[model samples]
Target: MHPENGLPENSPTTRVFVALAPPDPAKDELARALGPAYAAYPRMRWNRIEDWHLTLAFLGEQPVAAVDLLRAPLAELAASRAPLSFALTGGGHFDERVLWSGIEGDLEALQLLAEEVRALVREAGIAFPERRLRPHLTLARTRRDDPASVVEVAASLSGFAGTAWRAARLHLVASNFGRGPGPIRYRDVASWAFRDPAAGGHSR
Candidate 1:
């Protein structure tokens, strides 16, 4: 609400985050595996497969102008780093509510990348709460016994181990969350390919 006008203020801001998306094949495999769960747990708010991503830094809501300041720096950072290899292996639930699939492969490298990403966010003068990074793809959420059965669902995928794929890009995304919406949706603001030494550039 605009206090001065006593009306809604339409400030241009974006709910942005930095993340890495899984390749289509990897996501498809996991989707197939969850076919049964999709039927059995219809009540749980399952995330659209296209929306799955491993978030590194969530900058909450920032003025569009401020977010623009990050573009070139992130691109340069992407150019200096190489794509990472990862696999979707196993599953777990957060606090018996939110369901997620765990990550596998060089976690140390992933952690380092996440750290560097956060550092870059800080350097951008964006303020976000600091928290330890736990890499996972958010699969679904249950609001309490909206299905207390989430535990069973998580345990069911405990041994899921998908084949490995490279994390090829650095994605800056804007989300339509808490915007008087149905399911939240996301759109890519910009993405930069990781440096490929042989090509001397990224595919983006």
Candidate 2:
């Protein structure tokens, strides 16, 4: 959200996305597995545990009113679907600079859901860059000086296989990306249950 007159020039646009966060139990499980890497990769800028999430659609910046058109449609899409079963499996690096944990199980369903979200965004007249979905939880960022650290860390986690968990909520989130100097923080604009409570389905 932006306030005219009192905010920066770019305030009129907000950075937003659609995503799903793992429940505390699932996140905790991954955290435990990475305990050793935490100390070994001290220079890496680790993301806070609470901020971990898998983005379904990255809808960069847009007029706040344009996003409003998506509210009802997204809720309806989520309600028509059921929760997906997923597990954190292994690890990887992007350009050897970003470390992430992989996602597996129900992958076809996950891809279909993401495609639907992108389509809904288009229907709302929202435009965004198209990137192939590589499902993962971004764990940290490595520095240019020591790109090899992330590779070692990724190798160590190659055998990790976390317990399966249900993904039940679809969240529309806004991020404080260019607003100030600090770690990026995210807040949910709104969230909807994937399965409707009206027919014996519930949130996790």
Candidate 3:
């Protein structure tokens, strides 16, 4: 169990897996491409485009203190792995509620990154949620009446194709702040390079 954040040993804090995010232009392009669809479903709580990221894994809540122990190995993993190049293609919905854009290019690299992050988390004795990594950028969330709107949005962006972007670093972020009654904010507590310069290959 990790240490808790001054919460009388019972407050819930979410633990998640995060990776380096795409550049601003890439994210903005996706947002612009998705704007019309979002206009159609005003009720949906669309995630701000600035929050788009490529998640490598999702580690459930843990004692907050455990992060220090986990950071070293995670940094090493990042230093050993090479960067990845990818593009955005198409749009879809999750359980008819959450809307997202699909990712293309270098998917194999993404899978490898997920596996490495999972192994590192396990090595630190942290309990992680079991779920396959589905790499996609979340765009918006829907309400009960959102199914039809979601379908329409999905059909409209069926042919989206964005320019490719390269990923160079891995970031450990905090999501507790900027979530409500204000703009959402994500803080990167730590980050490391995608690969070791000497080896000319991604870390194993």
Clashes of each: 0, 0, 9
Q: Write down the lDDT of every candidate, Cα atoms only.
A: 0.84, 0.84, 0.73
For every candidate in turn, the CA RMSD to the true structure comes to 5.3, 3.9, 4.2
lDDT by residue for model 3 (30-126), tens: 8888878767777776766666777787665556567556778988877777778999889888888767789998998789788888888888888
On the 0 to 100 scale, the lDDT of residue 192 in model 2 is 85
lDDT per residue for candidate 1 within 1-204, as digits (tens), equals 334422224767878889999999999999988989989888887889999999988888887777778888899888988888999988989888889999988788888888888888889898876777899999988767565667878888987899999999999888877986366777778899989868664432
Tell me model 3's lDDT, rounded to 2 decimals.
0.73
Q: Please, what is the TM-score per model?
A: 0.89, 0.88, 0.83
The ten-residue window of minimal lDDT in model 1 covers 1-10
- Model 3 residue 71 lDDT? 76
List candidate 3 segments past 4 Å from native.
Answer: 1-14, 177-185, 196-204
Per-residue lDDT of 1-204 in model 2, one digit per residue for the tens? Answer: 334322124546677888988999999998998999998888888888988899999988776777667889999988888888899989999999999999998888889999999999988878898888889999988888999999999998899999999888998877777766555677777788888545775533
Residue 174 C-alpha lDDT in model 2: 78
TM-score of structure candidate 2: 0.88
- Candidate 3 matches the true fold with a TM-score of 0.83
lDDT of model 1, residue 47: 87
